[model samples]
Structure formats: structure tokens, C-alpha cells
Target: MADPFGMTELTEILRTSIGLDADVRFDGELAETEFAELGYDSLAMIELASQVQRRYGVRITDEAVLDQMRSPREAVDFVNSLLAGKVA
Candidate 1:
């Protein structure tokens, strides 16, 4: 079976980048943001973003975007859109 989220390649990139073990389907809601609650901190976010850029071959140069990516789900959606040639 194909991974549902993996349909968007960047979602797979996010999983690899963030070491996410669980499936994440992001709808981009701020109320659902929970990365820190899930044990991701600044260091983890930075590492994840770096890996995302490297894997996706896109430069995520906006620091504000890092602050806004507050959960594994959110990060997956954001990166997925970016890779799809869309804005998150």
C-alpha cells in the first residue's frame, strides 16, 4: 500500500526530517498546533527544517516560517505545499 501522506512527497520528507513515527495529516489549523507538546523543541525544529530543505531541494530561508511550524502535522503540510509549487 502507498502511504497516504506520502502522496505528497514532502510529507514523506517531513517524516524523515523530523523522525516522526506517527502518521500526520495536517489541515493547517493553529488550534491544532502541538509540536512542542509532542517533544519537539527549537533544536529539533531547526534540524527538521534543515533536513527538509536538503531533501526537498528548496531553501526555507524564512525564520518566521520556523516559528509558525508548530507541529509535525503542520510542518508536513507546509513542506508538502512548498514542494508542490504552492504556498503554505
Candidate 2:
């Protein structure tokens, strides 16, 4: 079976999804605190989620989920759960 998650893909997704500069390092292990530390706000979360939804074809209707995401890993897990048919 394919790897449940692709690190390179995830990194690329995050880099584009968050509008990060190409030179920025996106290691795919950012924590929620790191997001806050980096100044990610409510609007940024919405935009990021929207970008992820469009790119990954995963719908994130619950805004709370985005609000609850404290890290890139959590966001990936949430999207993976939705893709696995765990949320509908």
C-alpha cells in the first residue's frame, strides 16, 4: 500500500497552502505553537484550509477544526481522516 502520508507532498501543500515564500523551509512538523509563533491568524487559517481543500480535494466544513489545528501534523491528520471516510 502507498504510504498513508507523503512528506514531500505534504510539505509542498503546506508551502503553497500558506503562501510561504519558496525559500522558506517547510519541514512538515510544525506545531500549533509554531503557527501562533509565526503569526498565523484566523484569516490565515481560513485561507490555508481553503487552499488545502482545493488542492487535496478534502472538504473542511467545520471551521472549528481549523481553529483547533495547532500544528501542521494535526492539520494533516484531520485531512487524512476526512479522506479515509472517517468524517462525512
Candidate 3:
């Protein structure tokens, strides 16, 4: 199995999903920050899910990204669950 999904990877995908420049650092705490506050809406979440699927070979549904996942930390944890086959 691949290594666990993490913030660094998500950071890149998140920035790209929102069309932010790669060099743009996220202001405030990343784990605590909501995706909406960071400029990601439903569409962006779907895009993030797509990128993650392509890159991670993991299938995270748009519904999971939109409804289950919230902050970056939640995303990481949710992804890890899927990766570990422990999602409930």
C-alpha cells in the first residue's frame, strides 16, 4: 500500500484546486482552517477528490469530500481511513 496521505501533498493539491500560486502560503492554521475560508467550495472539493484519486489511487467520493471532510486534517484522516480500510 502507499504511504498515508498527508498535509504536504494535500497542500499542493489544495492550492492547485483553488488556483492559488504554489508559493502562496496558507494564512492561519491549516488544520483548523475550513476549506471555504481558504477559497475552496463544493466544486473545488470535487476537483481535489479527482486529483487525489489520480495521484493516490484512492477513491474518495465527491459526497465524502463535500459532506464528510471539512478541514485539511479531516481530509487527511478520512483518507487514511480509506487507505487502511477502516472507514465506517
Q: What lDDT is obtained when candidate 3 is compared to the true structure?
A: 0.76
**Candidate 1: tens digits of C-alpha lDDT, residues 1-88:** 3422333553465466655557655445632667688666777777767766766676665584566567655665666667667323
The candidates, ranked best first by TM-score, are 3, 2, 1
Q: Kindly list the per-residue Cα lDDT of model 3 for residues 1-88, writing each as its tens digit.
A: 5546877777788665657655755434867677788777888888888888888778987789987678787888788878778433
Best by lDDT: 3
Higher-scoring candidate on TM-score, 2 or 3: 3
Task: For residue 9, give model 3's deviation from the true position in Å.
Answer: 0.5
TM-score list, all predictions: 0.57, 0.63, 0.76
For model 1, the stretches where C-alpha displacement exceeds 4 angstroms are: 1-33, 62-65, 86-88
Q: Candidate 2 — which pairs collide?
A: 32-70
